[model samples]
Target chain A: MTHRSVFVVSGGTGITAEAIGNSMLSQFGDVAFTQHSLTYIRTEDDCRQAVARIQAAAEQDGTRPVVFSTLVNPTHRELLNQSGALVLDLFGTFLQPLEAELGVRSSQKVGYSHAVRDPSAYRVRIDAVHFALDNDDGGRTHHYDKADIILIGVSRSGKTPTSLYLALQFGLYAANYPLTEEDFDDLRLPEALQPYRDKLFALVIDPERLTVIRQERMAGSRYASLQQCEQETRTFAAIIGRYNVPSINVTERSIEEISTRILAQTGLQRRIR
Target chain B: MTHRSVFVVSGGTGITAEAIGNSMLSQFGDVAFTQHSLTYIRTEDDCRQAVARIQAAAEQDGTRPVVFSTLVNPTHRELLNQSGALVLDLFGTFLQPLEAELGVRSSQKVGYSHAVRDPSAYRVRIDAVHFALDNDDGGRTHHYDKADIILIGVSRSGKTPTSLYLALQFGLYAANYPLTEEDFDDLRLPEALQPYRDKLFALVIDPERLTVIRQERMAGSRYASLQQCEQETRTFAAIIGRYNVPSINVTERSIEEISTRILAQTGLQRRIR
Candidate 1:
């Protein structure tokens, strides 16, 4: 595999640059690349310093480094463009067109770049995150009425992480409940969840995967056994079928995929903007 | 006060499209935009359907909607190009240049678009999320030995959310410890956290903002009073000063900004790649 040095440069958090760079690089599974970030580069002096670093890196490696950037300042961008590297200045490529389409001059100031962000949306994230933590893993059933969606699954079925992702990323009030052995006694929906049956989103995972995950958590308990994993998932399916709750198998999906699927299936509008 | 409809269309999750669109649109602070996501769009048919939706939206609104997309297929890109909208197809803008730079034909496959993603990176995220939650809110100091960084702050000073974001987004093992009144009684670091002194990163917030956050949580209690907020923050400063630990004022910062600053200040490498 050919090795390359990749750098993400930006004026603010560099999240936008980092996100796009990583997303694009994932396509080249055969390439071996090391990534670095130059975040919070604000002044023209900062841009000059970053370009010097990039130039040094390119010379040291004897191969042009790949630089992904989102610099709003044209002067700063011109300096970076002249650097001895393959600079993909994303803002340089799209800003003029966006300015034309909107029929307004961009402030040209550095952006506080973030994913799904604004002051109001920031508030929503904090509130949702607190809600998710407070109501995590069936810790408190008293607050389900306020939850946008409730994730239910057997223990180690990717509930807690999904709940936090939905809350912290998209600003949704998400709560998760782990279905345990006690719930498998009758394979019936728990009484506390009956009132909010319509708000439930189930996560179904491969029994083998669940067993492996449990083993990592508790070494050699019955919970880590394949028999218990199968039993819990079987009971989980029965309960979901009995109630006809919307669900998806998360065997090979990432947390982002699971949350996006839930958003699509449940028709929940993400309050990100 | 112009109102614009913004649609993020992608062959995959549309997360990158949405992120770039939102980040750019935020620069035009005067215009109002309602954001929509067309996620998991994989087929030519999906592209045609999405263009129709965007065109119909333009017709209904009298002004053309802005469509940001990342379609991998040329045929699909051609169809979307004809849509009566400001079609800022991001992939079309950068792919050719990226392909030329790499000396390799780009795979042009529909991306698994995520902020930071891959199967191995996905495992890191899950383990880190679990670790963060397990050690949240000073719940279990037993696992301090494994934490990559420990976030210490007064209650409701943005510790937990930053810890969760660091884990979920950056694959860092972060644990948050909330400082309390009892810790302030003797004006010393807690015995539990004493051994991990060098690993601590303090969050110092404005007392007024801290009071407001506490008021929202407790409602009309001394814990939510500005006096107590001042006392706690003062004590927090004294502790960090005494230990010569690094810290940030998180009152005006978002979780992403806090995490990014932490990464920069602590020289911590994010394992997202």
Candidate 2:
């Protein structure tokens, strides 16, 4: 299977770019992909820098590559004009025409409106969207019959939210499984999951973020302790390494970017839209 | 505050339209409006019939005008061609422009994919989106100070999912308050919540659907029994009635339609987006 590079998403105000990018990522299956958002790009120089990165990804890969982007403005369009990759402009192509046809003025509320003050809600929805992408039965052999993807992660690493997002937004049957201490100590996946090891997507996150998340749920609780969170995170990472399983660190990116990268990396052809 | 006679969002996918409409619903304080979705209209005749109902709504008391159908297809648009109310064509406005800008063969995936199955995801997201509209701490009296809009209900009544959707999708700080048995007995809004009663959007559901959703999480458990579900639902309805709170029953309807209607009836305008 050939791996494509460069997925771009541009569109509505709130989470449109991230949402579309995440959808495209689920289609890719397990190779790593880099996502650079132009939301912070302040100058033409920054735009060119983004273009260079896309050009590099294209040169490194030899396939019908795709670069998905969602831009409300035309700046990113000019940047990608020379990138030699398939670009997806979500805003101008989809949102604008629909706005015109519907005769409604632009509301500018879709992607850019996320409230950072309440990162708890942001993280939850982000996790929901990503969790909904696993196409395999939630790490259980019997349930594989129902899964389009299986997501494995330690507690509060964002499986539920991501799973809901994928299943809800895309009609994908996504299931999630929590990795327990037993699974880590055993250092082996269940026999049922062994056959579909290649289909698993391990969501890795930094201990600090994990701790913060757990603390919100059970403040001052042992489960929310930083030490426990770090230990579990480390063990989970080692487990993935031991099995040669592919994983993604969700410490730095938003849910939309993370899901898109996973789909792109996985190279799983989405059989249904 | 000049309340629009009706706010009809008749475009985009059901999920997106609901999400936007839900957010917009929080803006009109105390003014009543009714929301309807055109998803059920399988024929042009159905579309015309739905429009007639909407016209009747617009002609009702101008303060509590009706918010009409979100026509998702061209046929619905034809039906609304002469409807004098405010028509919001979300799908048509968002989809075409996105597809054209992307230069893709189709924009179906990103613009308006249908919720063919397991629509719970979309409903949750849309509810969250709607709640986010009024999530604020300023000038919202004590008890009400913590929330802009508090979604109260028993388990599996779609509270958490909706709250997060409101926060993430529309930047609303929507917080959910679960209705415990104690609160049910009192059958009144928390005294703290009384000051903001005007801002409340009660989400009531049909006994059957409420049972179905709760059963999914606790299958075969006593909590999942239809009798138990029905009893709880009745109690919930009684509580709303005792308080004389306004609400809508979400049964045989998708979340998009229900949330849209909630917005219209509330006469709430979404925060600028």
Candidate 3:
């Protein structure tokens, strides 16, 4: 099998290139790819240097690298094209037609996706993040009314990260509550959560996976034991089923998928685009 | 002034459309647009429904709507094109050139960016996010050894959100510590932070902005007072200066800029591309 290298190059934060690279990775698995790389080349000189580096690596490995770039500068793009790699210009392939269709010239600026100039949107995201931290693991339940969505799960069931993702990505106010042994014993939603039932979304994971995650944090404890994890998972599922709470199995899902499913189920609007 | 509506339609997660919309907003202030819009239409029927909705809205105001789309399906793209609106096709204009350059067909899949099938990258991001939450506001200083970067700041100075953003977007292990009155009184770094000095990055903000942020949390407390805010800001600045701690003023900056600058200054590698 021949080894292949994939490089995601960009003029800015490289988010666009990364997104494209991720999409490609999902489509084509890691079978032939030895390296998945990122190069942030902001200027013409940096672009040339990056291309030179790619060329040097290709020469050594005898495998022409695949480059996915979103460089907006024409001069830099020309230099990248001359590098003898399979260059995919994310912007060059699209911007001209978009400009003609919109009846306006493209700004052709780098790092435009996540610019710092928009203070209001930034502030909203920051506030939502702070909310997530304050209300983490049911630290404060009084603020559930203020939350756009409340995530409920057993400990280490991936509530905290999903809460933070929703806040940072969509500027959505998210709060997560951990279901404890007491709640599991009673097999009911917490009294505090009753008022905010409409906003509650449960996240559950496979007992085996939960055991492995817990073991990493605290080995040889009841918390990390498969038996305890199994019990907790069963109780949590019962509660979710009883309440008819919208839930996702986080056993094999990413925070992105969990958050997206919650958003789709709840129809919660993002505070920022 | 005329009221105008802008819609970002995509067959995928709509991230590209959203990025372009945000860039346009920053370039042209929200003079013409009412709200930043996003419509994720994955199926042909969904596309027709979205177009019908747009057509209905356009008929009401006689102002043709502006649609920025990344529909990869030719049938859906054609439907979008016939919506009687000014449509900018992000993928339709770019995929052909990309296909020809690479001599391969595009996948043309919907919701490809955050697909759950690719779990390794997603797992890394989720783990990084968990690390961030575990170490938030110096919650668990013991894990500082695992952190790629540690952010220190006075309270409400935008540390939490930036930490979470760095984790979710790049899968970087980021931890943040809040500088309290006790640390400022002695005019020294927290004893717990001394060992991790190399990972330290400080965040500071304008006294006025810090005061305003605090005021929202605690209306009448001394923490929210301008005098207290000014004193804390000065002490934090002095500490950062004394230690030569790499720092950024987040007063007028977005979390995106703050996180990007932090990553650039620290030279930390993103776990994910």
Candidate ordering by DockQ (highest first): 1, 3, 2
True contacts kept of each: 0.52, 0.00, 0.33
Candidate 1: residue pairs that collide: none
Ranking of predictions according to lDDT:
1, 3, 2
Candidate 2 residues B136-208, lDDT tens each?
Answer: 2221334445455666666666665555545444334466565656666666766656666666666776667
**DockQ-based class of model 3:** acceptable
What would the TM-scores of all predictions be? 0.95, 0.40, 0.80
The lowest-lDDT stretch of 10 consecutive residues in candidate 2 chain B is B109-118
Point out where model 2 deviates above 4 Å.
Answer: A1-145, A180-182, A190-199, A207-234, A267-273, B1-161, B167-200, B205-238, B249-273
Q: What lDDT would each prediction earn against the true structure?
A: 0.85, 0.53, 0.77
Q: Against the hidden true structure, what lDDT does model 2 obtain?
A: 0.53
- Candidate 3, residues B137-177, lDDT tens digits: the string is 98889989999999999999988888889888788999999
**Number of the predicted model whose TM-score against the real structure is largest:** 1
What TM-score would chain A of each candidate receive against the reference chain A? 0.94, 0.51, 0.89
Steric collisions counted per model? 0, 99, 1
Candidate number of the best lDDT: 1
True-vs-predicted CA distance for residue A95, candidate 1, Å: 1.4
Error of 2 at A268 (Å): 5.5
lDDT by residue for model 2 (A50-124), tens: 677777766776543455554444665667666766665544444444344334455543233222212233333
